[model samples]
Target: MASIDLAIAGLAIGAIAALSGIGLLVTYRTNGVLNLAQGGIATLIAYVYREMAVVWGLPVWLSAVLALAVLSPGIGVLLERLVFRPLARRRASAAESLVASLGVMVLTLGMCAGIWGLGAQTDTPAVFPNKSVGIGGHHVGVDTISTLIVILVACVSLGLLQSRTKFGRQMRAVVDDRQLAELSSVPADRVAAAGWAFGTTLAGFTGILLAPRVSLSPYSLSLVVLETFAVVVAARLVSLPAAVFAGLAIGILQSELTQFTVNGSLADIYRTLGSNLFVVVLLVLLLAIPNLRELGDAGSAGSFSSRGGQEDTGTVAERSKDLVWRVAGFVMLLAPMLFAPSDLRHAFMVPALALIFLSIVIVTGYSGQVSLGVAGYAGLGALFSLKLASGGMVGIPHLPGLLAILVGAILVAPIGLVTGYPAIRRRGLTLALVTFAVGAVVSRFVFEQPSLAGNLTVNPLYIGGWELGDKSFYVIELLGLGLGMLAVRNLHRGRLGRALLAVRDNTGGAAAVGVDVRNLKLLAFTMSSVVAGLGGALLAYSASSFSSDTFQPIQSLLWFTAVVVFGADSAVGAIVGAAFIVAIDVMAPSGSSTLAVGILALALGWLPGGLASAVRGVIRYVAEQLADQFVAPASPIRGISALAPAALPAGPGAVAPSSVGTKPAVASARASGSTAGVAAADRVAADRGLALTPFGRTLLGLVGGGGTARPTPAPARANGAGPGAAGDIDRHATVGAGDFGSRNHVEGGHR
Candidate 1:
């Protein structure tokens, strides 16, 4: 009977996970977005529902309807229309859309915190009445029964909707080819909107159901939704039944694992696993899954967004200028040592964090791989450094900080290789999600476990008898930072850079060029992790303590956003961004920096290339201005000089009598050079001002006047139109109200 009760309890939790998984899958299948905002959306709706039912004293049903039916779906439509639609219109890569989704997540969480605060909301009223029922000779909670029914209804309804209705057919058609569907007169926008609505509604339902099982804190709630990724990954983002079954299986298995008992340290390990079974399920499933069923075009370059910087194809002389700029930037970093002791201590965080961001730049910016698990690697480095310094190894005694950092980095490299192997075939959002899952699991199972990381401490490096002070320590950090920057610069130059660029630009092309992409990816992951480990060691030493919060999964998200905001590919930008973040936190109230960064990341679509890249663009433009000022202008009259000596002589000799019909001609000739130049400039200015040309004006008039201007026929052809056009017009009809079939002609005509 006890076993049956536990099984029921586990199944109830699984049922909720099944709900969240189905929501994620449906959104992905229909819109081709993995919806990283699922947790945020869930958290928002749960809070709203709580506010309505408990705080505002609304009826349970009314609150549920308002929260689930209106607020949740509205959020979906809002995100689709605002954040996602622009990216989709631009055909932004899956990776960009993934980051945007993360932005939405970060934005919503910030809003929740600003509005509701981060404290646990124990008063979150459950809509389902607290009642029990007799089920096969055992008592069952009403909430559990309700959750099961909701899950079943959603699954069956979605399955039927997808397999049956015209809506489903249209959705699949749109998913296959959005432009093609539009050409066929299918309502692509409406279908996408419907998908968002349904997906978000399911999210709300799951959130409400799960709220009763745990205290409602932002972090805990978000983590719960993330752990459910195990089910979604198990489904491969395709099978509805599979996701549900996987969820239930994990829940039940987790419950069953609690029955076992072990002695000594093994017991502590069991307890950790038992409490964090869902996280374990997530990590295991992500690593075990061979490949994800990613949506839309698989070959689409969705992961690494091009920052639109001009490719540097300049000579060695020009390249030397770039080297000078880099050197100046390094000098600027070193200038911080002049600050007071307190300020210098704060500056120490910059190099440490900069090294961490540089790792992201290498893995994400250079190679177009998205990793959200760098925090996990960093945390491990700190732990390993502590272990080495504590003389905890079987044979080794306590080591100095420098030796410990080296050993920690070497120890951490294999962890990266292990994770990177799974990442060989994965890219974009799938890779990001998988890495995030790994980070979350590590946080819960290792970092948070008292038996593992609770006693971590930092040991300062001593040189002879001189212990490094804050100023000296900051200098040492800068040296490590410099080494990291040098390594990154090497990766970004020469043959290695070309190989990485080739891989980033096109994997197939890179392979065709004889690049070993798999090995390159693994190599990048290994090196990046090593650098990140070194950074993490410095971060721990700077703090003089180790806390699990330092490497929370969400911190990885913030760090990634900060890197992207500062221009992901720029090492100097990474350093600047780290300083910016640290400065923001020091100067502003807590969480303000997150809010500011979140806002900036949300607006990254319009800015393009991020704040760092934008600054670089400005600097380059200024330098170009100065260079142009130093160059002499060419003689404007030189082209005519070669042919015009005789002409000038003839004109001087013939200020001569104008012919009878030559009055207008003489005036026009007199208008040559200065007058003509002025007229021509006026015309050019007008064209620029109006943004139009003669041909453009004519086309605009034709289009505005509602006339379908027929194409002029070739002189050889009797009729202007091609054969079979009249008969097959409907068959070859294009999407949109305009003649999409003739888009090239329209575009060329406009140009």
Candidate 2:
């Protein structure tokens, strides 16, 4: 009877989790994007439901229907059209789409916080009666009964929708190949829209159902919903039944664990297990699942994108741009020191945050690994620093803050190396989930547990028996920042940098070309963690106390979004992003930076490579424009100097007359279909300012487009010209509709 009561207790919650899991799986299966924003969407829809039903006094059923059928799906359709459609059209990688979804997550959370003031709501309205009913001489909550029925209906309905509908077939086509489906006139956009609509409607329903059971806050409710990611992961992001079963099993297991108890630290640990069973299950499943059957792994680079910078020609431009960025960043770092102690104290977060951002740059930007658990490493670093400074760890003496930070950061490197093992095999979304699980587990089992991270105080810094002032300590921070920059630069420059870039671009190709992909990835993770730990240590020391809230799993997501939106590939960009965050906290409203980051991230489709690449391109374009104003332009016929010493023009984009034939000679040349015709055409081409340089001719010859430069054979004489007929190509080609004649004759004729 007690076990039956526990199962009944868990039933409603489990059903809610299944609902969210189903939405996540369906979105991934149909849209080819795992909606990282599902939690955000869930949280938002939950709030909307509470607002209408509880606050506005609307009927619960009416609110539920409006939220689930209208508002939630409307939000999804809008996002699909605005945020995701462009990405799909351009064939964005799963990694890029995940980042875009992060943008959405960040944006949605920001909206909730801005509107709801970040407080928890306990008065959420429930659609079903909370009272239990007697069934077969056993008690079962009406809500549980209703929810179980809803889950059954959802699963069977979704199964039929996918297997027994025209839209479902279209959705499958879009998921398999969006471009191919579009080419086949399948209306990929509409199919995608429908998929998102269904997914978000389910999300809305789940949010509404779960709201009454949990304290509803932007972060709390979102984390609760995201915890159900374990259910989907257990399904390997595919199976419907697996998600349902796993969600129910874990829920019941958690409820049943409450029946058993122990005393002391073990009791606390046991209680935590019961409370966060879902989070722990997520971590376990992610690590133990052998491999995720990623839907679009074939084209996924598993790295943040900067594809918009395709025009970046490596030259002095990069050097010049980097120098300018350094100068500007240095100014921003120094300005904080001039503020009042209170304000300057707040600025303490800047350099440390930059270090954390750089760690992301190293992993995601440099090595092309999706590392979402850096917050956990950062938290561990802070915890380690405290223990080292206070002599909390056995066999170690208390140390100064600086030494503790160094030792703690270095200590985290091995942990990173171990975590790096998964990255060696996984990429993109799989690696992302694994890393996020690591962070969540650490946050729950370590930071949130009093037995692990209680009574942590900021360690003091001293030098030569003297306590450093605010500005001096800031100088030390600057030094550390400089060192991090130097280390990152070393990793991104020369042979090693080339190898990393090679591996980032194409792992198999890099291995084929003899790059040590394994060692390099491990090194990246190791160095990245060290930097993150150092940042975390510094971050803790700068604050009043070491607080777990500072490194919450949600903060990791925000930091990643910030880093990515600013520029994942630029050290200066890391500094810029950190400064932006610190500045927002100091000057703006709460969560403003998050809103800004979300907006920018959602625009990654256009920004490409984040804000950093766009800035570099603008800088280079201006530099080139200025240079062009001062310097002599290059000559098209300049190659003739090397071959024949022919005189050339003084400016670029110019055609030199020395190599071109005169008009009388061009007219004298016969337009025949033999080698003579080829020579005659070449002369005519030069007269028309299409002169082929010696080098161009040679290069063209290699590609079967030699000096002859003949067009492909026109389909049996384009526009119905006779075989062997040759129009006056040069004269008519320079004309209008008449020119179409020469285009046809010359394309069809050999010449």
Candidate 3:
């Protein structure tokens, strides 16, 4: 009976999760775009509702209706028109759409943080009264009953709409293939817009209902809603009924778990597990499920690559220019060493962060693998390094900071192999969710474990019993960065680079061609994880402290976004992105850097290849224009004087005097470089049995020599002849034969 009551108590959360899962499933099914920003939209709507009801003194029903009905759906329509429509029109890849949705998520969170100041608000108003009633020995809250009723009605209505309505059929058509649907006379755009509007309304409802159950904050509610993604994942993003059922089952199961009270150290673990059951379920489902059949095209991760202009071998001038830019970049990277101690301390994060960003570049850019769990690897690195240095880890002796960092990175490499093995089969959003789940699991279980990470310490790098000061350490970091860059350069060149590129461009094709796709992917993952581990260790040592929060799952998303925004494939861009992020955060208020990155990412559709590629394009265009200005145009053929008539072959094709010497007076009057002179020279050359170049033939035709027919001599001009009439007749027949031969030759050559 108590368990039944607990399940009833859990029904409110279950209903909210149902709404969230349904919203996600609907958006994905209708628009063929998984709405990662659903949580963001929910958070935004929840905040607006709270402000309207509590701060602005609006009626509860009015606030709920205005926020859910007006603001939520309006935002959806606006996003469809502005962000998604452009991507759809361009036929952007699914990975691109995924990134855009992430941008939206970050932007919304940033906005909420900026407006609400990151503080928790507990004064959220509930739409349904918090009154309860007894039902057969179990007490149930009115709000809980109302939520269940609402979810049932919503689900039934949606099922009927999808099964019975023409608009729903049109939506299904659009989802199957937007272009085909349009060709079949269905309004795909309108259908997509309607889908988004309805989906976002459900998101709004989820947020409004859940906000009163928990503290209203920018991150808390959003994260809570994000955890509900488990429901959607379990449903495979297809079945609405499955999603609803999963939500309720998980919610009730979580509540039931709370009833158990274990003894000893396991108690805390058990409690944490019960509390975070959704996260655990998400992780387990991602790993346990062999495959998820997504709707529409299951796009590859290659869309993240830069779509720059045509590839060209660098000219000496371009090479020199690139060298100058590289030098300037190095100068910028090293300049921080000369700054004040405080500023230098802040700058220390640059190399470490850049290294971390470069790991993302290696995996996502070079291998086309979508890894969202880099933060997990980094956290593991930090934890392992700390444990090794303090002699807390089993079978490992206390070591100096440098050795610990190295060993920690080396040890983490195998973990990458373990994680990357899953990626051999998974791709796109499935792979993305799997990686994110790994990061979340690590954050919750490993990083948050008091026994493991609570007493961790990070010591600065040391060599030969001599401690390196901040400046010296910074120099070492620069050296480490240089080594990382060198390794990346090696990866980007030669045979190995080509192989990786082949796999990235087309995995199945690479496999068909006998390339070991599995091994190459694992190798990329291993190397990237090592790089991330090294960076994590350096990050810990730079601050001379360790905190799990430093390597949170959200930080992974930011790092990925920053790398992409600055040019995912560009090492220099990674360095610049790190500096840019650090500078923005330092110069502006908190969360400003996130806002900046979010804005740039949102504009990724318009600015393909990101900031670095855009800059390169502009520079290349300018340089080409300048080069064109200095190039001279071709000179025209001068005159027949350049083609001696005496050089004509003395054969059956001997020069005819009538044709060669009767150059029209009008032709001589024209300038040497004129079109007429060029044509006359070509005709004279051809008459002398010389082969005509294509350009010369074209010139002769343009000036009416080869293409135009000559007027026939008057038949027997009154006395059966004029002066040089026989020569004129012979010349005309010879010239006609030469023109025919030349035209045939040109035509044959072209073919």
Best by TM-score: 2
lDDT of 2 by residue, 1-751 (tens): 4988888788767878888899999888888888888888988999999999888999988988888888999999998999889988877777778889999999999888878877889999888877889987788888888878878887898789889998778888888888999899999888888878988888888878878888988888888888899999999888898999999999898899889888986887888899999989998887787678888643344345342312112334346776766787888899987899888898889999999999999998877888889999999999999999888967888888788889999989999999899988877777888888888888888898887899887756889888888988888888888889999988877558756765676676556535689999999999999999999988988885888878888888999998888877778889988998889867877777777788888888777678877777788689789889997864343222322212322243323222222243343343223578557755554334333321110111101111112222223222243432221012212111111222222332122
| Candidate 3 segments exceeding 4 Å error | 307-328, 631-751
Candidate 2 vs 3: which has more TM-score: 2
Segments in model 2 whose C-alpha atoms lie over 4 Å from true places:
297-299, 302-315, 635-751
Residue-level lDDT of model 3, residues 289-363, one tens digit each, is 866877766765666666331111123443443453366568769899789999998898889888899899899
Which model scores highest in lDDT? Answer: 2
The TM-score values for the models, in the order shown, are 0.80, 0.83, 0.82
Model 1 C-alpha RMSD vs. true structure (Å) is 13.1
Which tens-of-lDDT digit does each residue in 1-751 have in candidate 1?
A: 3778778878878888888998998888888888877887898889889998888999988999999888988988988887777776766667677778777777777767767877888887777888889989888888878888888888899888988998889889988888788899999887888888889999888888777678876667877887788888888888999999999988888877777778998787788787778778777776777667777755333234333522222234325435534665576578778888888777778899999999998898788788888899888888888888888655778788788887987788999898888778777656777788888877877888888887776767787878888888888888889889998988877557746755765566455435688998998898889889889888988888888988888788888888887777777778877888788877865566666777878776765657755665566677778778996753332212212222321233332111101233332343354677544433332222111111111211112111212222112111222432211111111111122222322211121
Residue 112 alpha-carbon offset, candidate 3, angstroms: 1.6
lDDT accuracy of residue 318 in candidate 1: 29
TM-score of 2: 0.83
Top-down TM-score ranking: 2, 3, 1
C-alpha lDDT of residue 569 in model 2:
74
RMSD of each: 13.1, 11.1, 14.6
Task: Tell me the spans in candidate 1 whose CA falls farther than 4 Å from its real position.
Answer: 53-61, 299-340, 616-751
